[model samples]
Each structure stands twice: as structure tokens, then as C-alpha cells.
Target: MSVDLETVKRVARLARIAVTTEDAERMTGELNAILGFVEQLDEVDVSGVDPMTSVIPMVMRKRQDAVTDGNKAADIVANAPAAEENFFLVPKVIE
Candidate 1:
């Protein structure tokens, strides 16, 4: 895919960047070179490759799933500036 001067100008406008005529010409060449490299990558064969989360393999650490604060509602409400009926109260904003 080749990038033209008009395409470079359009891209610069869309990105909110101010580019001179000379800068646009330089950018057009650079963008075409980048697209050519991407086209080369499209020809590589990866049909047998599996998607990877990381290049190195390691086991994630596990922890117990039991709840440790199932009955601490009163303790948590005590720290609130204004709590009522086990809920935090805030100033009403709308009628």
C-alpha cells in the first residue's frame, strides 16, 4: 500500500497536526515504507502457532476463597461521617 501526499495531508488534518508541504512529502514516503513492512509481515505462515500470554511459562499463585469479613457491617459503618441503618448518608442534590 502506497501513501500519497493527499492521504498524508488528510491524516495530518484528522490527527489535528499542522504539517508543512515539505513535511507532508517527507511523511508520505515514511508512511509508504511502514506499510510495505506490514505487507511483508502478512506473508509469514503462523497456522500452527498458539496465542501466548507471555514468552516465559510460570504458574500463578492461588489463595483460599473463604470470606473473612462476612459480619463486619457495624465496624465499617462506624468509620462513616454520617451512616444510618447500615448505609452511608450523603446530602441530597436534587428535588
Candidate 2:
């Protein structure tokens, strides 16, 4: 895939990057090189390869999903500057 100067400029605009004409020209070549490398990688044969999250094999540690602080609503509401009925009260903004 060939990246043109206009495409690079458009990408810079979309990314909110302040790019000069020289920088855009340089980026055009660099982006084209990266896309060409990806195209080359797409040509590689991986018919029987399994998808993996990481190169090293490891298992994730599991934890119990029991609640540790379920009955602390009064303690939590005590710290609030403006709380009522175990709930924090805020000024209504919407009409």
C-alpha cells in the first residue's frame, strides 16, 4: 500500500498533529514502508498456527468474588460533606 503526501497530511489533520510539508513528505515514505512490511507479513503461511495472547505459557490467578465491605454505607456516608438517607446529596443542575 502506497501512502501519498495528501493522505499523510489528512492523517496528520485527523490526529491533530501540527505537521509541516517536509514532515508530511517524510511521513509519506515512512508510512508506505510500514504498510509494505505489513503486506510482506500477510504473505507468510500460518495455516496451522494457534492464536496466543503471549509467547510464554502462564495461568491467571483466580480470586473469590465475595463482598468484603457490604455493610459500610453509614461509615462511607459519614465522610460526605452533604449526605442524606445514606446517599450523597448534590445540587440539581438540570431543569
Candidate 3:
């Protein structure tokens, strides 16, 4: 679960990044620190917590699932070169 100097160099090469020796050494320590923090997070107890979409307690906002024509056909075709009956008229591509 730790990032080493060799791993850093290998990852940089795989990502097509030019990592100088000095940059790779620096990144090795930085990446190890990040992994260490993530490992610490795994120690927390969350068995009682309910999964939620947001941190704030609130019900999910919802809308009716009724289906209908969006009523925006005319607006959608307003900028077309030729629009008829709220439909875009395109040139025939094949004979």
C-alpha cells in the first residue's frame, strides 16, 4: 500500500510523463503520504452509518416520471436553414 521510488518512476513512464530523478524522488514521498492517509481512513467505524447522497440530512428532491413531448421542437429548430412544422429539413444525402 506504499509508493516507492521505483513505483513512482514506473507510473510516470506508463503515463508518458517525463519524471526527472529529483521529481520522482519527491513524488515518491508525496504519494506515500497520500496512501498513508487513505489507509488511516480505513480504520474508521462506519457500520452504523446509513449511506446518503449528501452530508446534510434531507430527502431526495423528486419529480413525476410522466412522459410527454418536450414542447421545445419549434425552439430547437429555430436556427436551422429550413424548418417546417417544428422539424428541421435536411438535404437528401442519398438518391
Candidate 4:
């Protein structure tokens, strides 16, 4: 689809951007060029092309999905300036 200055202006407004007339014109030209390139790509033949994630096949490493008790609450709390009852203590803000 072709993008004109008016269309660019509408898009800028919808995106809550403050676009000057010069920027709107520039963006319109850029969007039109992008669409033109996409139209060019549409002419290529890819009927029997295989879908690929990468150029080379990869073997992903696997790991067991399990949970264990960390049991280091005192060690972790030692770093804090002030802690109470397994929680961080901060100054009260509300009246």
C-alpha cells in the first residue's frame, strides 16, 4: 500500500507524536519506499522452499525441571541494613 503525507500525518496523530510538516513528508517518502520494497519481494518464487529457523541444525541442551529448598534466609538477610521476621524493614510513610 502507498503511504502519502496525509496518511503519515494521521499515523503520527494516532501515535501521539508531534510531527512537523517536514518530518511528515520525510516519513511519507520512507514508508512508500518500504512498501515498494515489500511489493518487489512479492514477485519472488518460493513455492517449495523449506521453512528454517537457522542455516545450520542445532542440538539444544536439556535440563531437569525440578525445585529444591535454597534454605539461606539468614545468609541473604545478613546483607540488609535492617530486616525483621523474614522481611525487609523500612520507615513507615503513611500517617
Query: What TM-score, computed on C-alpha atoms, does each candidate reach?
Result: 0.61, 0.65, 0.61, 0.59
**What's the lDDT for residue 46 in model 3?**
93
Encode model 1's per-residue lDDT on 1-95: one tens digit a residue: 79899999999999999999999999998999999999999999989998776788866668989877668888889999999987899999999
User: What is candidate 3's lDDT per residue for 1-95, written digit by digit as tens?
Assistant: 98888999999999999999999999999998999999999999999989999988899989999997798887899899999998889999998
TM-score of model 4 vs. true structure: 0.59
- Worst lDDT run of 10 residues, candidate 4, spans 60-69
Which regions in candidate 1 have their CA more than 4 angstroms from the true location? 59-95
Best by lDDT: 3
Better of 2 and 4 by lDDT: 2
Which residue pairs overlap in candidate 1's backbone? none
Lowest lDDT sum, 10 consecutive residues, model 1, at 52-61
Best by TM-score: 2
| Candidate order, TM-score descending | 2, 3, 1, 4
Q: Where does candidate 4 stray beyond 4 Å? A: 59-95
Query: Which window of 10 residues has the lowest lDDT sum in candidate 3?
Result: 67-76
lDDT measured at residue 60 in model 2 versus the true structure, 0 to 100: 66
Tell how far residue 73 is off in model 1, in angstroms. Answer: 16
Question: Clashes in each model (backbone N, CA, C under 3 Å)?
Answer: 0, 0, 0, 0
Off by over 4 Å in 2: 62-95
lDDT of every predicted structure (CA atoms): 0.92, 0.91, 0.93, 0.89
